[model samples]
Target: MIRSHFDEDLKQLHREIVDMGSFVETAIASAVTALKSYDVERCKEIIESDKKVDEMERKIESQCLWLIARQQPVASDLRQITTALKIITDMERIGDHASDIASLAIRITDRSFFPESEMIFEMAAAAIDMVNSAVMSYVNYDMELAKATEEKDDIVDDYFNKVKHYLADVFSTQPHRMDVAIDYLLVAKYLERIGDHAVNICEWVHFSQTGEHKSTKIF
Candidate 1:
């Protein structure tokens, strides 16, 4: 009976994690659209919608705590609860980074042809996809899918580096644009960091199931 109860609660936690993942994905998509179209209202919308993601994170965190306290989980059960804790943390911070990107977009709206917007969007899209797969992997214990996501994360890094190297060239030739260039660079950096966090969540999920860390902090 206890095992059944724990299983049910784990399902609820996983569902909430998926919900949060959707919100994060939406935030990234909206942010990129706002950047491309120069829409301040859209930026504000992203900022306001972030509240829902925050609430979802808090609710899932509460569920995790309740499970840990009431079920007194051990072994893999304990790992699941702890994994939920870490998952929410990374998800919430990813949401925060999305908000940061939106805010920066608002500031740079009048600037001409903001640097590397497409590459940054591509990075965010890849990260969002990985975050989605990571949550699903946790729910299904799909080790194969988890392993695939680790590779996709490398693709995100490649795009990230491409933007970095391009920015280096831009700044060297057009030093007067340094301020705007730096802003765009920071947005790319934030999105790359967000991808790293998503990969971290996948590693933790894989670890929770296999008892081995999937990411060795190597990539």
Candidate 2:
């Protein structure tokens, strides 16, 4: 009976994490959309939504701790709970990056300032894809998907480099646009970090499934 109850609790925990992932994913999308549309209201909304993401992280942390203390999960079950603990931290950081991007978007008053706009949008898309796939991998316990998600980080990195090069050219020709260019650069950096966090989530997912993170075996 206790084992059955513990199984149900784990299932509930998984569901909650998936819900959190969905929330973070939406925030990333909203942040980028607000940037492109010059919608301050939408940016503000994304910032406000970050508080909920923090609260979700705390709640999930408590749930994982309770499971560890009460169920005393062993082997794969213990790895799953531990991985949940690690994954939430990455998810929370990703949320912070989303919020940071939104905050930066609000700082740039000139809508016409972003000539590297297309590259930035592409970067955001790649990061969002990583977040989605990482969360889906955790939801289904699919190691292959987790591995693939890690590979997508390269795509985000490539876009980040492209944005930097394009912005450097802008600065060389139009020194007056430096301020706006810096803000856009920061947004690209945040998206790059978001991609990094997604890869972290994938690493934890890999750990949960194989007791290995990247190439190193933990268990």
Candidate 3:
């Protein structure tokens, strides 16, 4: 009976993490949309939604601790809970980056000042896909999917470099738009960081499944 209860608790923890992941995915998507549209109201909404993401992280963390203290989970079970603890930290930071992007979006005075590079939008899309794949890997305990998701980080990085070059060209020719150029650069940087966090989550998923921390050297 005790084992059954503990198993059920673990299942509940999984559901909560999935819910948190869903919230973060929405935050990032909305943030990028707001950036493109110069929608301050939507940006504010993403910022406000971050609080709920944080709450979800705290709740899952509490559950993990309770399982460790009360159930004395060991081996795979302990790894699973501890991996969740680590994963949520990454997930929470992903939420923060989304909020950071939205904050930047709100500060821009000229929407037309943004560069014409399509790479920024592509970078956002890649990061969002990585986050989604990482979370799904955790939910399904699929190591192969986790590995593929980690590999996708490279695409985001490539997009980041392209955006940097594009921004540099814009800055060189249009020195008066320096501030606007820098703002867009920072947005790209945030998206790059989000991709890194997604890679971290995938690493945790790999560890949870295999009990080995996947080397990020390849990343």
The candidate, 1 or 2, that scores higher on TM-score is 2
Cα lDDT tens digits for candidate 3, 32-136:
999888899999999998999889998899999989999999888988898889999999999999999999999877767664646788889999999999989
Query: Candidate 1 lDDT, tens digit per residue, 127-214?
Result: 7787778767766878788788777888888878888888898789988887778878888888787778777777877877766775
lDDT of 2 at 100: 96
Ranking by lDDT: 2, 3, 1
Best model number under lDDT: 2
Give one digit per residue, the lDDT tens place, for model 2 in 25-126: 999999999998889999999999999999999999999999888888999999999998999999999999999999998998986866558879988999
lDDT of 2: 0.92
Candidate RMSDs in Å, in order, are: 3.1, 1.1, 2.6
Q: Of the pair 2 and 3, which is ahead by TM-score?
A: 2
Q: Write down the TM-score of every candidate.
A: 0.88, 0.97, 0.94
Model 2 TM-score on a 0 to 1 scale: 0.97
The top-ranked prediction according to TM-score is 2
Q: Candidates' lDDT values, in order?
A: 0.80, 0.92, 0.89
